[model samples]
Target: MTQTPRIDVVGGAYEEWCLRPAWHEVFGSAGRAASAIAAMAGPSKVTLHCYADARTAQVLEARCALEGTRLVAVAVPATCSFRYTHALQRPEVEVPQSTYASVVVRAETVLRFGMLEGDAVVHGKRVVYDPQGRLTPEPFGANGSSADELFIVLNEREALAITGLAEGATALKLAEATRALHKATGVIVKRGPLGALVLDGDDWTEVPAFETETVWKIGSGDVFAAHFALNWAAHGHSATDSAYRASLATAVYCDGRGFPEQSTLDVFPAMPIRASARWMAGRQPRIYLASPIFTLGQLWLVEQVRENLRMFGLEVFSPFHDVGYGSADDVVQLDLEGIHNSDLVYAVADGMDSGTIYEVGYARAQGKPVVVYCENESSEDLKMLEGSSCVLCKDYVSSIYRALWTAMAL
Candidate 1:
């Protein structure tokens, strides 16, 4: 009988404060996420290597026991951040002062290289890479042990920072670069809402996200890394199979469940695997639809515009369609959030609603590309926007194409 692989999870442990209009809560980091993975792996032992303050260490110790996990906690100052977001709003995170990630990365090196031992180690920190975009294995001691599989799972932002790659760079390039620099058996790049990309040697696969009306997404990425490590390292499954299982596990967690059990496997369907879009020149662009929809007819028109843009493989964020006409403050806050998250702002300026005009200005102030659609207004009509290099379109169909094109440039 094959021995079950003992897993070590190396990462940051921080306190997250999530605030929305309706809810607010605090959560754990590697401890919570790794626990969920440990639960999924049944009897296999998972050792969490992370840093925390005294109080946080105590809390993590309890959480680990709740999920039958072991802790390799390092006592340090706990890192905390306040994230403000709504169901439809992108988060605005504020970090007061936290060297938590940097400190934890240093601690992770000591834990992995100097102390704890495991059959497989999963690393989850972008700080492991230096300014040169190379994984400095010398510091972490990534020895090529034939019996051990080292896996690294990083979100898109983290991957970009570590590899010194810009946004829209091919995921394959990120993965290949990391693999070449580190002694990683494989690298999994998490794309948040879209999906995850699995890279092993020359082969790469995209694991589609299991869509759900997510209640909380604070630790979904960590949960994904844990499950992938379990499947790929412990169970000896292929990278593609591991990523598929991890996606299902993530869906279960997003659906408000703590973790998944082997008996309930049928509840989560196996997500499809496809060729990664990382190499594609233009993956779908995220567009912020800045328009007025005070009336039902206007809302319908915005919906039509959204569908039209979607048909062109663009992700549209029509505040009116997404958040409805909520409170004045709520609408403003969420729309601003959407604009901040978007690649470009596409405004419908037919009537020049004050809110829509403000959104266009806000996008411009933030240095984002702005594309405006007006029925009769020429470039001369919106002189301020034109001076700001905003793209103007007279027709609706043409505006959508122009917005899509402008978004790609952004």
Candidate 2:
């Protein structure tokens, strides 16, 4: 008998869904996958889909590299079957039980460097174009309030996030229109208002939409896809249960912020319930990385800080710190929002950006901890943060540990 391939978790452009302040909670749906992949072995090959350009493509590459994983970017076919979506319009239970997802283990990379499934271990957790939020004057300072209170708020979005349905979807529109419908693992169809469905694998499970006053139904289906993929990858859950959980989570998320919810999954019994508990227990600290991008020094410094924060049981969010999104406006917006929400701010001073200096001042002004990673051996650059209390770490790891310890009053 062929040994079953143990999937760490499902990823790809799928994760970008969690980025929007509105849809992040739902699309950022599966924590288990992160945890599952984390617990695996060495570097692994992961295939990525749904990428926009070379920047994100390289980002995917860089992220995988940091995680001790290898990433292979593949074009996500424009036409995905409507079946791939969990329509999520129909009702499953008589009383609509709340849906939930279990956190799967994020073991260290299990697959060897050159040995991913089909020469790939894991793949895309990609995010397409999310043209929301702002272009800031002070890049990386958007969400820099403090790491202690790094929770996302619902920013009621205006645009809808929609993925193109499978090629034939525009044709038959019915999700089940598969060529060899019999050989495939069925489709997870996306339907507006009607909800989504999981057609194959096990029994068909109809997931209902969470009724809300209503806004835009843009990325609800993508949200459902995230949860379904998480459930499927983590638990090997039956199509029926996975679809149900994905549906409920999507509805709840869409109704509220349409973003990734930080709460541990709490709906159905995913295959690895303990995985959820472990991740929850880990409770990695949240780090809002703010810095000028493109320069190798800045990038390397940010990564080192992130690694240090992880050592201190913290989860970091520098989504914009990525060189791809590190455009001037992108960086500024990040500073604006990050300063508003972060428990502390870690500013890398390796590059030119008096604007970054402004953010440091902002963090200090707001009484949020500010840690500066100044590659230059000068105390002059640290002048901006003079009036406002802050820390100056010569190195990344020490600075991060110091910042966390300081945050904890240690």
Candidate 3:
């Protein structure tokens, strides 16, 4: 464990094709994987096994050229699917192949054999056996895929996705189920923005998330996984300490400023542990102003609403102000991002804009508290909006206050 382990990471790598109303290219999971490994403290060699087209290969090659770690990129032509992210549009993703061709490379020869031995191996998808013929099928299940030492890290939603379990499943239940099935040494369930739950043997520990205003939530999970793996693999740290350090590093990544450095590990004493949303009431909550601002009158009202929220000591993300009638894709992206980061959504339904209606539904779907302020009370007959469990208000000023109060209570 003292020496840097030559890690073999098997995962998907593809180009993220997007049109923010204009074409823009970005690296998808492959770039994230490389970045995560480079963020580790020590120098290491990383062999990334992923499928890519020619364009994806060039992009990944240029990116890894400057990375601190020794990079061995093995890319082959494989079926790829396009993933798109735009505002107002539901993310579109084409179905990709379930599996890709895997190879083992040693010395100067690429081994066509199925197995390659390593000190440790990371498998993103389900695998039948490790290089040493160790059974390591993911989630192990009731089937026999035992490992000498196994750690299963998954968030609540991930647990549901993998097992097809219901949303109300407790972290302890998921952990215990996985352990009973797989006989894992430990299972860690991450609670978004709250903290993480670690179950090692019979001892359970909760590590509070480091206090940091989230600027970007995109790659926070990747950062956490990278830190945990590096700490556990290279430093031989305990499951508890590894999860704690991973949480700290993830806090830095969420800031959207830069990668977590070695010094970030030492900065915890000055920071506070994150509290629940209810405890965050004293702070100014960010509000996403969702409404149709097409006409001059609509724009004026939007501005007035924004000013009122600002005067009430709340941060506002107004699509009219932030994203004008620019790229259709960009507008959708900005508003969705704003909604994701906002504490609550204040949707002014004066004209009943379709986009606003969609935003209200979207916000509610994400479990964000939504306050629908309508000038007319006649529109309340719509059962869908009524059954949405949102707070309906007719008065403007009272609606703002009620929404703010509701957000703080949550």
Q: Largest TM-score belongs to which candidate?
A: 3
Between candidates 1 and 2, name the one with more favorable TM-score: 1
- Per-candidate TM equals 0.56, 0.30, 0.58
Clashing residue pairs, candidate 3? Answer: 87-332, 87-333
Over the stretch 41-67, how does candidate 1's per-residue lDDT look in tens digits? 654476777665676677777877776
Q: What local distance difference test score does each model get?
A: 0.62, 0.40, 0.60
Which parts of model 3 are misplaced by more than 4 Å?
1-3, 17-27, 72-74, 79-90, 95-99, 102-146, 264-410
On residues 1-410, what C-alpha lDDT tens digit does candidate 3 reach at each position? Answer: 35655544444454445443232443444346446657665444555555565766776676666665444545445434444432122346544444433433232101010121212233322121111112233444332233445666667665656555576688788767756655567777887544788888899988877654323444466567666766664456877898898888887775543676686657644253545465454467788999888888788778767886775457899888787777877678888888999989998887677899899899999998888777574754445677888778655544655665555445
What is the TM-score ranking, best to worst? Answer: 3, 1, 2
Error of 3 at 118 (Å): 20
Clashing pairs in 1: none
Give the lDDT of residue 96 in candidate 1: 28
| Model 3 residue 194 distance off true place after TM-score fit, in angstroms | 1.6
Model 2: which ten-residue window has the lowest total lDDT? 145-154
After superposition, the stretches of candidate 1 with alpha carbons farther than 4 Å from their true spots are 1-3, 21-27, 87-148, 269-410
